[model samples]
Target: MRVNAKSQKPKTPKGFIGPIGFDLPSIMPIVFAIIVFFSAVSYSYTTVNEKNNVLDSIESSIKIADILKGNSYLFFDATDSGAKNKFASNCEKAVNIAQSKNINFAATFVKLDSSSSIEWLIENKESEIDSCTTADGKHLCWCGFSPKKFDSNLSKQFWSISFPVTVDVKPPGSGPEDIYPQSYLRKIIVVVWK
Candidate 1:
């Protein structure tokens, strides 16, 4: 027995310290959970970025519309007929400017009240006068016109002619000729920017 004890090796530590007995199953669930958490975080970040881009586009369109409205009102307020004519001519120039800057615009003169909703005023043709009354019953007439041809892509045609707008207008009696009726004549300009 003493001779055999030297030949045989002592029993190795085989409980928790043995490589074959190590538990890999205990670590797998923790690794899977960490992977799932990172996936969810990435998805949420992508969704928020897309929403912000859409909001920014809408804001830019609104700003362009405001600028177009202001320029139209100032042109209509000019004193001389030649100046008004020049102003009307400048609509094309404005369109060119916008096009150069890569902004989309459509201009139209809309009547406050009319039997027909959208009447396109033919260039070089006189506009048909229609009776219009304000909320307070001020008697007026208006003619709708636009210098730029209607392009389906940029124009938002769903709006009403009576849409309320904030624009300064010279009173009917101030100018040599009344470019606009006493009732507010708002030029509704719609913008769509890509």
Candidate 2:
């Protein structure tokens, strides 16, 4: 049952050849609708990706801060020079973990200070917006704000609300005593972004 190729024409895919080829007004609305649909999908995809990235950063930062709580020195003896040094080292560890996970974050130890050098909170300002001008007189300051952002554009989108978390560890009796000599409530605020 051999057939001659020249006798039969090649078949075209189903939608390629309409009865009326390229009808302008009739097809315009359909083309416009397809374009609009694709554009909307593309926009939604990018938006979702950006939001997911931001959330990833926040989660990574929180994890880093939580890791610090497991260690006692940062919270218990914040005023002690040794404890302060340990806290700084822990912050570095957080940064390293962020780098490995491709997240940008700044974690800090914040404590309340009655004598902060920052202008006293405005009368109408939220109570959480207090200053820490002399906290420990050393490693940390500015109350609960995040460190300055490395990129200006990124900074615009930073999630920077400070909240206090529990630090159950007690200050070591052997830590520097004259430097406050007692434990104060503290917060480990972690601001993360992609």
Candidate 3:
């Protein structure tokens, strides 16, 4: 028997089915949620990277301050005139390095004789020097930064603390009236916003 063409149904092609459809309202929320999740992740990553960079800069500043302390000792040990000159040159070299690296520092060499001089040095330089104290009429040479400004977010996020170094000196004489030649090196570092 011949099949009737008028009653024949069309056949669907294999492997040509379209994507399944869902209600737009139901699918939109999921898509939006995925987008929001990715956005939050990207933002968090960028923030972490920025904080790490700030931390690295602060660490570098501290290391540079320590290097300056070592140079100060070398300066103190140079007794000969020529050696002293060389020491000064070395100090300049260290200073250049610090500047090149964007590390800020201030240094002073003080010879303690009387309480007046010690007080004077402390009064004039306390903001920069982390600490200054007098003992046996000897003054301390201190190197440090004046004021520090840091990233507020990083500071709060990491719970960081400030710890600075201070150098002390001992005088040869016993009384405040006598002068002393002994001195020591001190270092301090502060992280501030530029």
Instruction: Tell me the lDDT of candidate 1.
Output: 0.44
Could you give candidate 3's per-residue lDDT for residues 37-124 as a string of tens digits? 9999999999999887578656655554445455334322212223323333544655676567665544444322222332233335
Instruction: Look at candidate 3 and give me any clashing residue pairs.
Output: 149-192, 149-193
Task: Please give the lDDT score at residue 101 for candidate 1.
Answer: 55
Per-residue alpha-carbon lDDT of candidate 2 for residues 2-96, written as tens digits (9 for 90 to 100): 89887687776677656566586678898999999999999999999988877876676567766544454333343344444444456566667
Off by over 4 Å in 2: 1-22, 71-85, 112-154, 161-180
Q: Compared with the true structure, what per-residue lDDT tens digits does model 1 show for residues 63-95?
A: 544444444443344233333433344545555
Candidate 3 TM-score over all chains jointly: 0.40
What is the model-wide C-alpha lDDT for candidate 3?
Answer: 0.43
TM-score of each: 0.37, 0.54, 0.40
Best by lDDT: 2
lDDT of each: 0.44, 0.50, 0.43
Of the two candidates 2 and 3, the one with more favorable lDDT, higher being better, is 2
Residue 8 C-alpha lDDT in model 3: 90
- Compute the lDDT of residue 111 as modeled in candidate 2: 55
